[model samples]
Target: MLTSVYRLVRPRQFELVFNDITLDKSHVIVHPVRLSICNADQRYYQGLRAENILRKKLPMALIHEAVGRVAFDPTGQFEEGTLVVMIPNTPTEKDDIIAENYLRSSQFRASGFDGFMQEYVSMEPDRLVALPEDVNLSVAAFTEIVSVSYHTIQRFLRFSHSRRDVIGVWGDGNLGYITSLLLKAILPETKVCVFGVNEYKLHDFSFADDVYLISDIPEDFHMDHAFECVGGAASSKAINQIIDYINPEGTISIMGVSEDFAPINTRMILEKGLRLFGSSRSGREDFLGLIKLYNQNPDLINQLEKIVGAEIHVRSIQDITRAFEIDIHKIMGKTIMIWEN
Candidate 1:
């Protein structure tokens, strides 16, 4: 069957390309119903990536965060019309020591292959996770990123010291809000504080134990651990600032994406005996665990509802372009496209 794929032929340009998708019993067909715009997708749409990288990766469908209905399930595991979230990381091999997301052989959607910006996505049943039928569609669209926070926090739990009294999340963006919210649900007894430069954005973290502007933090304030959600050129400053305020031996989980190398203070890291690690795309298990968490805590999804920003109905390339433009101009929050193709 021929499938309609929207590809970015160049910056600020999208072309409708058709590709043949073999109708096989091994693959399940998903009709993407709701797609979320990501910063990575924005980078490609705006030509923010390196020229070489863009030259190689452009003319490819973008968007990894999406939810859809099972249009066809030959395996009989999921029924037709069932709601599901697609996992982007496709692993070629399994390893006991390294998770699938961490494996070098994994092919991530949008990054390594055609993403969900198509009429239909063909993926193995194992790459899809069922979601509650009544779940919020706009909130569900960005499950991929939420699962990243879930995956990172799970690792932080295993790697960090037992001092779970206070945890700091730097950045008041959607990620920081989600990370701090997840930390509260996962570690209710622990305090989660968010730090950011924007007071307006920081106010959105109403659930946080406390929100402080980075420059206004108390002199004696400290946290047992920190998660850096501030990426881009500010990556170095966020990491180094965390180092100064975090307690000795605390684990710093890096979830930010930076194009240029951001030099951090390694001297203080060594002196403080800090442990730093980076987390990116998540695996199937992370999505499963996160959905379970959402089910257990209904209020969690309610909180997620607050971050659902502009929801545009996209039925054509022009609509998709308008959606991306809206996403770029928004101060914060997720921009979702109700995929009508």
Candidate 2:
């Protein structure tokens, strides 16, 4: 079968390429229905990555967050027209102690391998999760993003020694909002405080126990554990604040993606005996857990609806470009691309 793939041929340039797909019985063919533009995609689209890295990674398909329908399934595992969320992390090898997401042999779509920006993507059956018939395709499109928060918090639960009370989240972006919301959903008894620079963005975090501007954080405010969702240039500042406000021996989970190395207060980390870790991408288990969460808490879908900033019906290549252009400027919420072409 020939698949039409949209690739980033060069910085800010995309080209359509055709590739033949030899479908295996172990794989299911998916036709992307809706896609969400991630910040990482924008970094590549805008050429924000280092020149050398860009040169090495160009001509690759550009999206990892997407929901699609099974068009062809040789094994009959999923019915045709079934809505599904596509998992991008492909792990070829596994270890007893290491999770698949952290496996050295894992191949993540849109990072090094071809992504789902194609008319049809042939994927291993395990790489796809069936969505509920009534599931919101727009919200399901970014399940990958929500699953990251699930993965991070699940890891934090294993590593933290604190009471899980008074949790703090740094950043006002979609990540912080989702992380805080997940914390609330998973541990409703715990108090979640959010700190960020943008008050307008913070307003959306009404579910949080409290939302405070980073500049006006109470002097005596402290957290038992913290999550740093702020990335890029402002990451250093957010990390410093998390270290400063977090209690001794607290756990800190870093989820942001930064282009350059960001320094943290090592002295404080050591002095306070804080445990810090980073989480990226996610695995099938996380995706399943997120679905279970949604099943348990049906209101989660309503809460997630608040994060949909813009919806673009992509009918042409120009629409794809326009979605990226609009996404780069969004301060809050996600810009979703409904695959119409």
Give the top-scoring candidate (lDDT): 1
Residue range 176-217, candidate 1, lDDT tens digits: 989999999999999999999999988788889999999999
Candidate 1 lDDT trough over 10 residues, lowest sum? 17-26
Candidate 2 TM-score versus the reference: 0.99
TM-score of each: 0.99, 0.99
Residue 239 in candidate 1 has what lDDT? 95
Task: State residue 135's C-alpha deviation in candidate 2, in Å.
Answer: 0.8
Q: In order, what lDDT does every prediction score?
A: 0.94, 0.93
For all candidates, the clash counts are 0, 0
